[model samples]
Target: MSAPDAGGESTRDREPVLRVRGLRKAYGERLVLDDVDLDVHAGDVVCLIGSSGSGKSTLLRCLDLLEPVDDGTIHLDGVEITDPAVDERAVRRRIGMVFQAYNLFPHLTVLENCTLAPRHAHGVRRREARDRALGLLERFGLAGHADQHPDRLSGGQQQRAAVVRALCTRPELLLLDEITAALDPELVGEVLDIVRDLAAGGTTMVLATHEMSFAREVATTVCFLEGGRILEQGPPARMFSDPTHERTRSFLKRVLAP
Candidate 1:
C-alpha cells in the first residue's frame, strides 16, 4: 500500500497493515484507553511513548487481542480481528508479541522456545521450524546459546531469544511492549540493537517503549499517549523536537531532563 511522504500527502492508496479506530478499554470503572486511534503501514516502526499508567501497554495488549476492548475496531491487513467470532489463534500467528518479561518457558531450550509456536500452532514440520529458528538465532548472535535453558541466559540474551521466537512465525506485524524495561542498564542496549536491526530490515512494528533515545532514533512515527489518549503524533524529528501539546512537552521535560 502507498504511504504518505514526509509532507503528509495522502497515501490512501496504500492501506495500513494495522488500523485502529475509536478504541476504548476499561477495568471496572477506570478507563485505561479512551478512543485511541492509530494507523501503521508496512515497514513502519511506530513507537508509543508516555509516562507510567498512560495505557501504552494496554494499547498493545488490545491490538494483540490479549485484552478485549469495550469498544473500537482493529483491522489487521483489512480483516476485522476484534470481532468476537474471529479466530484468535490465527490472528496471533500473523502478529507476534514480545513482552517486558522474557516469558520463556523454564523447561524449553532456546531453540525449542523459538520453534514451538510455528511447529505446533501452524503445523510446520519440526526440522523446518528448527532450521528457521537457528538461522534467526545465528543472525541475532544467539546461536551459541540455542541449547541453553532460559535460566542460563542473561536478561538481554533471553529477550533477544524471545524476539527470535516471535519472528520464527514470520508474523506480518510485531508488537513490542517495553521489551527492555526488565533488563539491566548495560544489557538494555543489546536488546535495543535487535530492534534497530528489525527496523532497518523493514519489519513492520508498533511498540510501546520507555527508551526515549531509542524511540527518537529508530521510530518512523512517534506518538505521545497521555491518559490513554494520543495527544500528539508525527515524525520523530517533529514529535521529539517540536511537540505541539503542552502535556507532551511537560512529559518530555520530566523524562528527557539531564
Candidate 2:
C-alpha cells in the first residue's frame, strides 16, 4: 500500500520515505513490538503516542536502526535497510535520531558536538560542517551557545542542540524518541517549538511523544499504540476528537483530563 503525504493524500507514485512491515522486537522473552506496520511519506510528521512501555521508543529505535528487530522489514527510500548485507553505518547517515536524554558530549563544545558526525561519518569538510552546524544552531536560537559546552546550557538548550546536530547530517528521515520527555514543565515548550518548526519546514519525521496536545497540533497522522500494537490511527482531529475505538477514547480521556 502506498503511503499518504503530509496532507494525508495518497502518494502511490512517489516512493515512501520510510516503510515498515510486521515489525517485531523482543528483549529476552518479552515481545516489545508486535506486528507493527507503518509508512511515512516525504513530508509527513507521524506521531506515535501511547502510555509508557507501549513500544513507542522501541519503534523509533528500530526505525533508526539503533535496535535490531527480531523480525521485520524496514525500507528507507525503497531500499530494505534491515537486510544483513546493508551497511548500517551508511543507512544511519541518511536517518537521524534524537533520544529523550540530551546525549551531547560534555567535553565537546556545542559547535563541536554538532559537527562531529558530519565531519567524521559523512566526511564533510571541517569548514563546511561548521558552517552548516552554525546555520542550523542559529536558526534554532542556539547561535549564542555554539562554543559553550553542553553542561553550560539548560536542558532545553542541550536538546535543541541535539536536534541541530541531527540536522547537520541532512538526513532524509528523522526519528525523534520522546525528545521533550526529560525537560522541566516550563522548558518543554521551547523544545516542542523546534519540532514545530521542523514540521513546518517539511522535514519528514516519525516521533514518539507523550505530549498529546503537541501531537494533535503538529502531527500529519496520529498513531495510538497499545501493548505494542497500533490499535488505531488516523488524522489528529479524528483521533483526538472522534476516535472510533473505545480504547482510543478511553486513553484520550485519561491523557487529556483536567
Candidate 3:
C-alpha cells in the first residue's frame, strides 16, 4: 500500500486505524458508493445500516481493496491504498473480512479453518497458528468442536469458525458483512453473541448489518447510507433517537419496524 497523494486524513502521529473518503464505485451507469466517508479509530465498532443495494457491502469490500474503487481514497495507518494500482494483498492482509456465508471448507475440521489463513498469509508455523486457533475457538465457545468438519456442526458453529479464521490473521480492522443474516432465526443469536463479546473486548469492527437492535447495543457509532450516499451518522443514541435528516428518519422507520 502506498501513501496518499492528497489531503484530508485526520489521523495524527498515532494514525487513525482506518479512514475512507470520497469512495465511489459503479458498474456502467449504476452508481454504488457515492463519495462515502467513514473513519474508525482503535477499538471502535461502527455499524452501517442501509436499504438493499445501498452499497454498504461494496464500501467494506473497497476498504480491503477486494474491489477496486472508481474514485476516492482509503487510508489504513497512513498508507494510501485507494489507488487501483496498489498491492491488494497487502491491503487485505491488514483488513480481515467475514463474509455472510459460512465459507469454511466442508472437508476441513473447525481447527483447520481457523488456522489456514494465518499459515498462508502471515507465514505462521502450523503449531503456532493451531495454538492461536484453539484459543480463538475457546474464546468463541467452539473449542469442543475442533475436530468436526463444517457439515457436522450447526450453522452457528460454522459462522463462529469463520470469525475465528478472520481473527487468526491478526487484522488491524475486521469487516463483518452480515455474518448472521443468513442463519436460521434460532441460530442467529449464537453468532451475534460472539460478535457482541468481540466488540465488548475492544475489537475494531466495521459491520454492515440488518440487525439494528444488535447494532444499537454494540456499536459506538452508527451510519445510515441510502442510494450510495450516507444519509446520517453519529453516536448510536443520536442516530437512533434523534436523527436530524428526514430521509434518515424515513429509512430507519422502514427498516427498524417490528
Candidate with maximal lDDT = 1
Which 10-residue span in candidate 2 carries the lowest summed lDDT? 1-10
**Overall local distance difference test of candidate 2:** 0.91
User: Number of clashing pairs, model 1?
Assistant: 2
TM-scores for every candidate against the unseen true structure? 0.96, 0.95, 0.92
Sorted by lDDT (best first), the order is 1, 2, 3
Candidate that would win on TM-score: 1
lDDT of 3 by residue, 8-52 (tens): 234535667888887889989999998788878899899999887
Candidate 3's C-alpha runs over 4 A off are: 1-14
Winner on lDDT between 2 and 3 is 2
Task: Name the candidate, 1 or 3, with the larger TM-score value.
Answer: 1
For model 3 the local lDDT of residue 251 reads 83
- Looking at candidate 1, what is the lDDT of residue 218? 95
